[model samples]
Target: MTLQIDGLTKRFGGQAVVDGLSIDIAEAEFFAIVGASGCGKSTLLRLIAGLETADAGSIRLHGEPVSGPGLHVPPEGRGFGVVFQSYALWPHLDVRGNVAFPIETAGASRNDAARAADRHLATVALQPFATRRPAELSGGQRQRVALARCLAQGARTILMDEPLANLDPHLRGAMERELLAFHAASGATTLYITHDQREAMAVADRMAVMSAGRFLQVGTPQEIYERPASEEIARFIGQGVVLPVEIAQGTALIAGQRVFLRVLNGAETGPRSAMLRPSDITATDPGAEGAVAGRTLSVLYRGGLWEALVAVEGLAEPLPVHLNRPARAGEAIGLRLTGGWLLPEAAMAAKAPRRAAASAP
Candidate 1:
């Protein structure tokens, strides 16, 4: 029950949008592909769903070829479900009608399709809105309707293309929980695509970070956050300050402080970047040895903590420091880095790698 994509490529106007990508998604695994907008995440999903033809490569499900050079499986014939960002419900259809459409399309009788729709509606807690039209429902309810319609189809693999993007912040949070519960109950292999790193972190069992039509790294959310493969990945995945450093013997001098490395990108080292998350840095006494001192530029209250911008020497940008207590602007403070990741030069290459690294970030 694995989905294997080999040499999957797509292009438009002679420019490659998805370039020679390969990945294996395991059965019932919640895998997410995350990147900035226009990184081709949605395009890849469209290619898999057969909405767009691939210029090259093949896609296999459970060892059966569905897409390749010549063979083409229509979206419905592939026995998969897709939930898009727009909710894509028929304007004239009520909730039950929308949910039953897929089942009915698969050759089920009207009564049987209605029954299956009822079951799926209950799974997503949308049974209460069974008679409401798409226009009559709230954004969250509309999203649930779309999801319920997909579930009613009973596809083993579910592809969601930023389905939560249309919801407000609070509704998005609620939907994320419902989505996870549905995935657990359905036992379906889910491929979620999003530009929101927080959404990817929340929903994925594993995630891939993409840029410029290629995956930079793939790993569990925690693994990617804790030990990013490169400075670019670290910056993309979360809030962090990538600082230049000098390394030797599993140690590095970052911001003038020598700290132990939890992970190193490779053996070769001279000048490299260290990922120092705001959580990894702490305020210290002024003039402390091996500590970097800087003037406070700004202090922002982030609900639970205050994030201060500190100006450090030998750095082109201001360093971000998360503080337990608020500090005044124009004040001075020293910073001590608890620990950090040592990114090798290759991981920092300007171009995508020719081969996937054997590490996760």
Candidate 2:
């Protein structure tokens, strides 16, 4: 392993924000850690970078202990490049100076640092703006400068904390491409933290879903999206909505109607819940056999597709469905289920108390 974190723990205000968190990242791997806000993802990154000390556990890089009992390496000494959400560029310095500062600070001559910075800037396609200061550059340009600076430092491990969060949506795609290219060229072990699941899925070779300071599941983006470990993970990742149903002979009874679909995970015949993505559902002809009936509550235009909220009888929550054809509110629609991930009875029951408590006034 290139990076190993064991039994890591961090607390704030007497509460365990990062409780016993641990992860292993291989060398030259692009790994993303994704979760909602205040899930201790950023704090975990800070702990790994040595910006903040770990209350317990240890961090190892290349089999060398960096944070542990009586041994804490300074952030600068850890040889890890960090890209922050704010870009963190030097205001007074031009692009080249901002990129070269880290190198020069690490005992390199000014000329050598400038030469190395130029090469890195060209790699990021920012060589033309070398003489411009951070104030003169656009948000995306400044981000590239920050990335170039990290590359100039020659760190094999790159840590980014929502680096594209500050950029406009249109500019995020370009930066993501550059990041992928940079990783391919440098082969750095990157640990990226983001609340955006789409962004993480677009870039990471593997990602972990985190909640309340613990990883709920770790796997490829497809695996996590297709077969979430639990209902919370499915909802968090926007994979789909979990629907309560009765299963018997591999068929789920929805809205007093039996619909046949493949149920991922080892689910037996009983009362349970299953997560079905919007795409897995299709609108069929009225009164179609093996179809679950629902009324369209609303239809929303989502770029290339129309998204509709379906209200089915015998179900409390509305089902979200993405449609290729147009849909009208209050229209009768028959939903055909093609795929779903089943959650065992115990897991569904476990989530009931939490949901009840949350909805209580």
Candidate 3:
């Protein structure tokens, strides 16, 4: 399914929960929607699922117009398999009964539905738990059941809303691999939504970063992380600093220091902002190129990556250096800014209920 959303908006009592929003998902693409809570990620999903009415805008599936009262397709008719954060399974139904439910609803005969359910159970490695109800299954087991049910729906497009939220850290990783395997074999267009960056980076073919109620940026995971479209995006992707800068001839002034830039593209101006990610800064000795002397405030060993807070109060902003090698806290150090890219405020979209940006932080 090539899903397209254009200018979708929903308002209640003059408050727009989901403001103007649009996205294009390619066929067989594993697209991801990420943002913070209340950025309307789930609401956008519901609109796609036909669970709520859009106050304005249009949704098209495979280029077919869908929206408005009479024209909207119901969830059951959409050929979508959805697995939610809670794994919404029937407590009364055993695993086989649960997986067969969707097939049964579509007019499959009892024997046919049971066979289909069995096949899907095998696919998700849940055949042994065929007789287990929701309560009898673990979190990951129940999630597999939900996914199996979705597959049995004869669905060509899959939508998941925080499907990994309930799983423990180890289980989350396991499910991610399973999802990719499923997508590779089935080639269904998937739209996975979540607020976790690690999850998004792991599973997404491309990440759409949202803020407020609007999409701030959309690109490959590398593009979103490495060459972010704006300062806000850079901040969201890496631990960094966005400081006010004085732009003059071929150089920008940070604090009282003249820092040169390798400008890629931007507007000419007096005052602008420069974004520097922590990873771009490295500890170097005095007299090294681009080195600035400073005192170390603190050090942290984060997931085997060392980080130092270098205090250069003259720079107005405390710079964070992400060490490529480990170092101790309170150790005097000199650091150099590799200097990140430049972005203008105008380049940033107005903060709408960004379903993607909600996951920015």
- Estimate TM-scores for all models: 0.91, 0.91, 0.86
Candidate 2, residues 3-64: lDDT per residue as tens digits?
88888989998898888877778888888999999999999999999999988989998889
The ten-residue window of minimal lDDT in model 1 covers 352-361
lDDT of 3: 0.77
Alpha-carbon local distance difference test for all models? 0.84, 0.84, 0.77
Candidate 3 TM-score over all chains jointly: 0.86
- List candidate 3 stretches off by more than 4 Å: 248-269, 285-290, 324-329, 345-361
Candidate 3 lDDT tens digits, 1-361: 3787878887767888778887778788888878889888888889888888888888888777767545788887677888898888889899999999888888999889999999988888888889888998888888888888878987878999999997899798888998887777667788899998778888888878777777788877776776666777877775777777777754676644566654445435577777777766767875565667777778888786777777875766678887767666666677766566565455344443333321211
Candidate 1 positional error at 28, Å: 0.6
Error of 3 at 62 (Å): 2.2
Q: Taking the tens digit of each residue's C-alpha lDDT, what string does model 1 give over 1-361?
A: 4688888999999989999898888888899999999899999999998898899999998789989999888887887889989989998989999999988988999999999999999988888899899999999889888888878887889999999988899888888998998888788889999999999999998899998888888889998998887777988888887877777766787666778776544454466677777877888876888678888999999898888989887777777798888789999898887887776566345454544322221
Q: Among all windows of ten consecutive residues in candidate 2, which has the lowest summed lDDT? A: 352-361
RMSD per model, one decimal = 2.8, 5.9, 4.1
Candidate 1 Cα deviation (angstroms), residue 299? 2.3
Q: Model 3, 241: alpha-carbon shift in Å?
A: 1.6
Q: Which of candidates 1 and 3 is the stronger one according to lDDT?
A: 1
